[model samples]
Target chain A: DAGITQSPRYKITETGRQVTLMCHQTWSHSYMFWYRQDLGHGLRLIYYSAAADITDKGEVPDGYVVSRSKTENFPLTLESATRSQTSVYFCASSESFHSYNEQFFGPGTRLTVL
Target chain B: AQTVTQSQPEMSVQEAETVTLSCTYDTSESDYYLFWYKQPPSRQMILVIRQEAYKQQNATENRFSVNFQKAAKSFSLKISDSQLGDAAMYFCAYRRRVNTNAGKSTFGDGTTLTVKP
Candidate 1:
């Protein structure tokens, strides 16, 4: 597909285990972001990258790690998953930070940590 | 720090009727942007409409419109002639206008809209 997509639309993991969620976009957007959607919390950014090899933390980045070695790919990893970390993960990309640039989001990855 | 709040957790409206979702934000910056996003069961975040802070007039997209009150820091969405397809989670978001802080969006908890026939 020409749009953004998330791998493993659904995932299940145990506490303390390591898991990674993948995101890919065909738009070659300069900015890529990872966000988690939980009940009562619409969506909070976890990490974002401006370009290849550059990433920054977001509101809920305490236990998450991200890498952007390519403009088309941005993957988020959980070093030690916890039940608190279980939520729907979404990946988004925008052409630029300009006000006219609207973000395009992937379908989302629902992760369950038991 | 900027924060967006959607007071209504869930709401329902009969088809062909109208419904409004309220959103309030706290920010010190003068120039910024407010947006409404819709997410259906498919979980795809779609931009419903957006309003620029500098503009005095509100923003509208077809059946969707926003009531942006900059002084009051309020941005509410009004949907007219609601349809069954309108049932979804609607989120209000804010973003700074500056390039340095523009890529990140601060989102509200979201308002779930249920449409009945």
Candidate 2:
């Protein structure tokens, strides 16, 4: 409850379905990030929000969408789930957009697209 | 664009022994930060250590330390007195200090480290 948390720790959905993974943080950090961990590719960032109402794309952002309407919440949405989109999604938060600040990670959401 | 590479796919060390995991990166930027993250079976990403490119001295935390070579663009993690709890997938990451690249970290493929008791 004191740190970052992710909802639907595990999920299973069919192709072309829409699903949203929720991430909440209690730290009120200014920067929040969404990343997907896949085999051979490691963890690739999907989107990052510098602050509430401000978000930017990362390395792999084609199929994913993210929004940060509130500083404590950053949710990632998969509008049309595909098998390639199945991976462990992680949410991270930091105090600011500085490189030295350590990121606090959530428990991660494991989603499977069938 | 910056890239991080963890050459070792897997590594093992006997309990109480020491082991080092190699990491290399390709970057033209002079100022950046490097980090090592540990992911255990529970799937939580824990920051093990961090090093700044401007600092000549390596960073050390308890049993974990990093050998940062700015010129070679190499950052390796060395674990001393390895324990069973140390078994996990270790990732090497890089982030540029510039504002445009801040908050975005490039992670390596990761090396799965096993500790033998």
Candidate 3:
């Protein structure tokens, strides 16, 4: 596919275990984001990157870590997964931060922490 | 900080009928964007429509349209001639125009739409 993609469509992890979710995009977009979708919260951004090696925290970024060493890749890691971290993770990218450019989202990764 | 709110948790529409999902947002930035995303059972987030804050004309895409009230801080999505494929979770989101902060979107809780044939 030419759009963004997330690996491990579904994942199962234990509490206190470390897990990393990988995101890749073929568009070479300038901005990429990581968000988690829960039942009542919709999608909350965990982190976002402006370009390679430039990342920033979002609304919920306490236990999560993200790095963008390349424009085509942005991986989010959970140092110590918790039960509350169980949710659907989505990766998105855009050509720029401008309002005119819409963000393209991936199929999402369903992560379950037991 | 920006916050998006979708008040209706669930909605139902009969085939060929129309349904509107309401969304409201709070933001201090004057120039920004509003978007409606549809997530079907497949869990892929698809952009349904988008509206720029500065544009006076509403945005429409096929059977999907939006009523953007900038002064009221509201953006609602309307789906006409509803089809079974239209049944999905609809989310409203807000984003800024500038690239200084990466333009992260703030999403609403989402409205689940059910189309009855």
Best DockQ goes to which candidate? 2
Query: If both were scored by TM-score, which would come out higher, candidate 1 or candidate 3?
Result: 1
Q: Candidate 3, residues A49-87: lDDT per residue as tens digits? A: 989998899899999999988899999999999999999
Name the docking class for model 1.
medium
TM-score of chain A of each: 0.96, 0.97, 0.97
State, as a TM-score between 0 and 1, how close model 1 is to the true structure.
Answer: 0.98
Worst 10 residues of 3 chain A by lDDT: A94-103
Query: For each prediction, how big is the interface RMSD?
Result: 1.2, 1.2, 1.5
Clashing pairs in 3: none
1 or 2, which is superior by DockQ? 2
RMSD of each: 0.9, 0.8, 1.2
For candidate 3, report its TM-score. Answer: 0.96
Off by over 4 Å in 2: none
Model 2 chain B scores worst on lDDT over the 10 consecutive residues at B95-104
Per-model TM-score, in order, reads: 0.98, 0.98, 0.96
lDDT of 3 by residue, B1-117 (tens): 998989999999999999999999999989988999899999988989998899999999999999999999999999999999999999998988776765578889999999999
lDDT of 1 by residue, A10-44 (tens): 99999999999999999989999999998667899
Query: In candidate 1, which residue pairs clash?
Result: none
